[model samples]
Target: MATAFKQIEDEAIEMARSVAYSMPIEDIDMTDSARFVDNTHWAFFERLRKEAPVHYCANGRFGPFWSVTRYKDIMAVDTNHAVFSSEAHLGGITAKDQEDDFILPMFIAMDQPKHDVQRKAVSPIVAPANLAVLEVLIRERAQKIFDNLPINEPFDWVDRVSIELTTQMLATLFDFPWEDRRKLTYWSDVTTIDVSAPDAKMTRDEQRAILIECLTYFTGLWNARVNAAPAGDLISMMAHNPSMRDMQPMEYLGNLLLLIVGGNDTTRNSITGGLLFLNENPGEYQKLRDNPALIESMVPEIVRYQTPLAHMRRTALQDTILGGQHIKKGDRVVMWYVSGNRDETEIENADAFIIDRARPRQHLSFGFGIHRCVGNRLAEMQLKIVWEEILKRWPMIEVIEPPVRVKSAFVKGYERMMVRIPG
Candidate 1:
């Protein structure tokens, strides 16, 4: 099975090279998930940023769309919410078009007054005071996880550390049952999994069933919270806030997915990605060891380097010109955060990972404008705390094998990575 998978990956890489290198600049398609799965999409984006920053693909898995690759252009598209709508009824925020029946109306996918109202309802989860409280808990959890590791024995760092830490954090935010915290991670995976991927164990129907299970479970919690006094937990906050309390059942499910994916994928993948990056760039790791304070800057650098969530889709609300191209009303526009993070013009030495660079947080990892990740600071906090705890123990965590990356362009992350630490 391993040998067969390797052959498939090799063939995919070869095919990606053919499409990315041999195709004309105008004809190139950046929406192919295979290119992302094989990690060959970087070259394509590099070419697009150089030749056509606002390239358009006539046909793609998600149909016709414009690829905004350069740093400035991506920012322009991301910040122009008036011209580009994220409304679920239009297309939501993925490359695939959101069908009406499958539409999930979360705040991130809404516009104007409605978006602000819904967003404000749950904003307290990452508020300054709340974060101060979460810090102590996060540190303690990190220390415990590190203390329990089987020293010198290879284990899946992604499963044991990344997922575990993030799952615990998510449970805290939701005030979920501590023992059943892993369910949060499972539902997150089901919410974002690409069933067409070769390694995806569940069918589309099965995936939807699991998501339904998640919605049902959370609904019970919502019912309990809605009747109780206001609490600091996310579910409770939503339940008590007037702006969110009257949300439709579908809206409730949508917001649940947003919080789950936001809370789970961003920090968890970055934790795993940072470890792999440190192994690849040993000098940066050594620098980090020499000056532990570098962890402060390194957290954002890791987020920029990994780019956990790749692209956010928006539908052109009105006919407008962007980057010297005429965009018709209702055209699909995709801002590839993964590509913009590597734009050399805005980010110096963009392809390399530097731990203590000036303006470390200037990248598009968390995006810009109103739709920027609400949990960005919290994600940074978790990464910082985990690294602080990690450095106090082992000198290094060594990757024993190549990581199995998730086969999707949407969620840029690791499925498994084997690592060992000093005994």
Candidate 2:
């Protein structure tokens, strides 16, 4: 399967390269992760925002779709959930159209009453009270992780720091076994990896096997939680909550994937991205070092700059007009959060990384309206704690070279980031 995917990826990259030079930017399908992995999507999106904020691509990898590139336009679509649906059955929430076999009915991909009810069930895990408890645990874990790293020697920060810290937090969220937490990171990466990308290590069958293993492990946890009293962990919350207690097997798997990816990607990438961004902008790093308190504002800026989840795809429920363009029922409309975060109109000097921006939180890294990221506050808290602890220990964690980035349009993340902590 990997062999096949490699072939497809090769063709996709060639196609992207060809279209990049030949076709008008608006007509180019930015859905190809290949374009993103190569870092060419930035210019493509810039053109879209300037020329065609509500542009249509008649032929895209995921079939035809409209790209909503501007911040205001994305907000309008995000807030108007009635016209633009996130329901999984109606092509789900991605530019890469959901396949029937791969459908997982998570609340993020659902609509209205069902989405609200199910979301309510697990909202407590990230609620203010829970976050306060998690903060102490997160700091303790960050200390342990930082203490164990090799000093004065180059190591992969993505694996040692970013993935480790997030995976630890994820385990705490689910009450997953400490030793088996790495499996959560594996599953999260596998869940979002584009099989066609060269970086995808597993074959299709292998990926399925791992996911089945994840479901099976969680099913055991769910079964145990169902019989026990209510608890703070995600599984226990779902088990005890009336709305989610009777979820179908696939539905359970779907929610599990959602929670895993949701918990894992955003913070993990931001941790790695914050390092890379600081390396790129030495002045910001110095500002942060001189005034460690800036971490409060810097955390959200990292999320915006990273834009972990690049886009959220919404389906047109009925014929509608968005940004003065006629959108047909069933047409896929993708809100490019990555592009919107950089829109100069909404964010001043949006392209630059300013830690102390007045309105730092006004970014679309977390989608707006009903389907906004449920664990966003939790993610921000984790990043804040990690950075706070990091500043206490190392003065600098220098990137050895350019970080190896993830090859996916959906998850804007890092694969490998080598760094050295100066002794």
What is the clash count for each candidate, in the order shown? Answer: 0, 0
For model 1, residues 268-378, the per-residue Cα lDDT tens digits are: 999999998888778999999999999999999999999999999999999999889999999999999999999999999998999999999999989899898999999
Task: Tell me the tens digit of each residue's lDDT in model 2 across 1-423.
Answer: 223433554566565555555677656787888766765577677778988899999988778999999999999999999899998988898787666786789999999989999999999888888889999999998999999999989899999999999999999999998999999998998888666555677776787778888999999999998999888899999988888999998899999999999999888999999988887777899999999999999999999999999999999989999889999998999999999999999999998999988989999999999988888898999889888999999888788766677888899988888888889
The lDDT per prediction is 0.88, 0.88
Candidate 1 residue spans exceeding 4 A from truth: 1-19, 196-200
For model 1, give the RMSD to the true fold.
3.1
Instruction: Judging by TM-score against the true structure, name the best candidate.
Output: 1
